[model samples]
Target: MSEQRLIELEIKIAYQEDLLQELNKIIAQQQHQILLLEKTCQLLHERMNSFRLENNDEGNEQPPHY
Candidate 1:
């Protein structure tokens, strides 16, 4: 291939690499957020279980809806 064509191809390849890097960074950030959310959910679940146990200890009264 001609030198100009080769240079153009190289430029295109470089742009693609940069784009790929940006996408990877975005994905990493999203993964981190997901992990944080999962931890929060786990903590909430634990808290709810503790609350339920506490309520049970206090006579296990039925709710108004029951």
Candidate 2:
């Protein structure tokens, strides 16, 4: 292979390595964010269930007009 062609290939490889590292970092960050969102959703679901139960108990009470 010509010296110029070898140099070009090395440059391309370096750029690809950098790009892979950047993609890996982004994937890791996204995974962490997804986990946080999942936990938040679970907490919100629990709160909603509790609120519903409280509201149901209140709904059975007699009104002031009765």
Candidate 3:
């Protein structure tokens, strides 16, 4: 290949490497966010279940004003 063609190919390879690194970073960040959201969902589910259990325990009681 000509010198100029070889230089062009090198430049293209460099750009592709940079783009690949950036994409990898974005994917890593997304994975971290997904994990955090999953944890939050689990916590909320636990809280909801606890609340339901508490309400069930009191479900048979009458109001003070009744």
By TM-score, who's the top model here? Answer: 3
| Local accuracy of candidate 3 as per-residue lDDT tens digits, 1-66 | 999999999999999999999999999999999999999999999999999999998997898899
Show model 1 residue runs off by greater than 4 Å: 60-66
In candidate 1 the C-alpha lDDT for residue 25 amounts to 100
| TM-score, cand. 3 vs. native | 0.89
| Selected candidate, larger lDDT, 1 vs 2 | 2
Candidate 1 at residue 37, lDDT?
Answer: 100
Backbone clashes in model 2, listed as residue pairs: none
- How far is 7's C-alpha from truth in model 1 (Å)? 1.3
Q: What is the C-alpha lDDT of each candidate?
A: 0.96, 1.00, 0.98
Tell me, what's the RMSD of every candidate?
4.9, 1.6, 1.9
lDDT of 2 at 64: 86
Report the lDDT tens digits of candidate 1 across residue range 1-53. Answer: 99999999999999999999999999999999999999999999999999999
- Cα lDDT tens digits, model 2, 1-66, are 999999999999999999999999999999999999999999999999999999999999999899
